[model samples]
Target: MNAFTRLRYRGSFMMRTLVSRSARLMRYCLLSLLGTLPLAVCAGEPVSPLLSPHQTIGTVNCASSTCHGSITPWEGSNVLQNEYTTWSRLDRHTRTYEVLNNAVSQRIVRNLGYKEPATEVKICLDCHAHNPTPARRGARFTQSEGIGCEGCHGPAADWIGEHAVKGITHSANIERGLYPTNQPIAQAKLCLSCHFGDESRFVTHRIMGAGHPRISFELKTFSALEPAHYRVDADYEQRKGSYDSVRLWAIGQALAARQQLDTLADPKRGHDGLMPELVLFDCYSCHHPMSDKRWTPRLGVGPGRMRLNDSNLLMLRAIVRAAYPDSSSAFDKAVRATHLAVSTGQTEGGAAPLQVVSKLSATIGAFLPRLEQQNFSPALQRKVLVALIDESAETSYADYAGAEQAYMAIVTVSNDLLSHGALKSTPALTDALARLLKTLRHDEQYDANVFRKQLSTLRSTVGVQERS
Candidate 1:
């Protein structure tokens, strides 16, 4: 039976008390526990950012062909002026809004009995375009820009002019309304808004059944894969501090874990008709072979009402153990509590799982700031990578989605080690990376044992355990 249909956490009084608490208070308490907020308001709905008055100054303000629209690189300034050109020419995000008009998207919405076209759907626009409330809109806030500057940068009506002023600190710009992409924590919150989803909008189980694509996100990989416009050179670093993909990757997992838990706890996002949102759980459980016998005992602790999609949490635990050994025992305690609450709640039968998840969310929030503070040096990164492998040494990588994430993570860490000159670029490592990627290509036929064996050989070649 679906966990949602089973006993739900019946701590309504406690839940109401939490809801009655100030958003700021809840935010702070969670921050105190985990030390990070994936969104400004971690609980409840979507992020309600503080932004400029009505009238987004507009993307046109920076769209002049000679300014940010230049086809060729402009060398006259420390910041390149061809951002618009790069976005228009190479960025898929620029065309996000148009995607809604596609036949598939239209059909999906139509099947859902939404009379409006996909382009007009609020759920679609929330992510596909830079749709903002009139109070937050400036004169130039155009849906045409499709997740324009203001979408990720906050409404620019208040900040655009001062942003151009020479020597204006990035923090000053942030104060004026620039979303602090320079801050990894802020960036994760911002990116995960669309990359993952929040209470205000999410890709629900119904949508998935309606043919919507499955969402996958990793901050560092996606940032690089974004064919990034901004260069992380000395000038950029001086302004934004150092660039650390490993740190971003680790934090992204933590933030993603928090996002999942938040969704699970939020009733609005957790249910659909009589079923709990199946999309929130491990897709492989239902989507895979009916008689595969792969799921003899779900989660290594017997069956439950729901098998959650805990890929991010798995990585977060391994990372916490690897990167912060001093906190590993404490961290494990918290992680185990969450794991047990979620995995065994319905099997054990209770309406208390969400409450448990809520408390742990706060614990994770407290850990995030400290997690961000640690240096994910190449050496440390190698440790975390190995820890991820060792911790997942069980049949954890058996699920297609989990295995795919593991593949990308392995590729990311291996590349990081290579870039930092920590791991020698040899044929063995190269072949191992290639083979791991190949398994991802054939998820239907993927062999977990082969993937694991290859990963172990990779460990030998990379020498991650020898030192870290």
Candidate 2:
């Protein structure tokens, strides 16, 4: 089946399975333990492995080369003397608070007229704040520092005490206690923990609510944001001292996490609400106009129930119209179709999902011809490239079917970019895209036919239609 059809059928099956599993687990627990055990005992079970905001920020931020400490760098890549200072002063995640405090965020909040719905209602803190754990760190935790190391890697306290020894270095510290980006599952879980939200542990919010979905995390596409510290091999095993480890970890993690989500099937149970907003998928894959409500990041609210803002969809359409002056009618039809698909309430897996793919294909068919006819003008072709990228949007599918679309999107966009003169200006983009394409092309577990066709098409299009 095509990615579109498979997405819908598989998604539906996965949802039912997830709900069944959750129910069965609950029933078994109730019969085996909950029925006999006290409420406190069940509650006492480790609710979440995630550290509290205070413990994470305080511990991670305090051991620094630039802010908390006197001076000097650690491991060459990071400063050991002033970690907090470096984070607070320069890190984008650290600056999320400033953005939240900005006039734009306040205006959105005022527009929503939310009467301070509690810590969970603080939308900005959802992705920014350290996730709180039952083991509170007294008053040491501060919410303003944004996400800390343990936020991504997990609480280091358990491993920290052991690994901090002067002469001891346990690989488990790197492998088990904290997420080693080396482990594909760990890396994906780490990212999805926040981006998609752990339904078992926290609520999930939409991506648009957090501001820019395009800037948000998608398994395959977002790997560019993280530092790959491991080497990826054909075995998909971790190799020490290979930068490629990071890339391997990403592919494995993305696939594994997406597969796990597919196993669950439903977007409602656990943290299904944490799925990225579908419209964000549109923005990422298609670059069409957004007519949804404006996005405003929140604190404490897990990325579980995040939804698209209608107004932003409108704004995006305006931008697309401005970019493709003659294709306004086509763009309008595509956007309308997209809106209708979104309104159809397709879960992570369903027929409504296929409609999205159909719409994207339609848009691409309309614009790609224009690019070819116009001799692939850098400016005009850029729009076509953007549409191609948008065509790869897989919000629901990524959470269910896998990151295949995302990877394809990257590969196609990179080709388009290189064809349109991006390689000369931005060599790194070219290199990164090339490496990713190579990995995708070679990965045995991935469907070779899809990559083969896409890579072939992309190369042929660039070679024949563009000026070298």
- Per-residue lDDT tens digits of candidate 2, residues 1-468? 543343344334434443343334323322321001001111111223353232342444455443345443344422244444444454456655556666556554554565552233444465556655546442555656666555555556556555545565435564434545433334555566555555443222232333322222344334432322211232222222222211322233333333223323335442335544343232212221245232233211123333322222232233244355676666656545544444444434355643553444444434422322232234543454444333323122212122334343334334334433453424444444444344333121234334444544544444443455
lDDT, candidate 1, 1-468, per-residue tens: 443222122122222322222222323322221111122222222233422343466678878876677777677576778888777777778889989989879888997889999988888888898777766665555787787666776766677777777888766766666666767777787888887887567888787667676677778666655546676666666655566667777788888889888888887887777677787787656654556666544344465345778778777777877877887877766665666777676423454878878876787788787766766777787787788777556556656567656655765665666666676657776677666665555444556777778778777766743555
Q: What is the C-alpha local distance difference test score of candidate 2?
A: 0.39
**Where does model 2 exceed 4 Å of error?**
1-57, 64-86, 107-113, 117-124, 166-177, 200-215, 218-241, 249-253, 256-264, 267-468
lDDT score of residue 132 within candidate 1: 74
Best by TM-score: 1
Clashes of each: 18, 69
TM-score of 2: 0.44
Best by lDDT: 1
TM-score of each: 0.83, 0.44
Compared with the true structure, all predictions reach lDDT values of 0.67, 0.39
Superposed Cα deviation of residue 296, candidate 2 (Å):
33
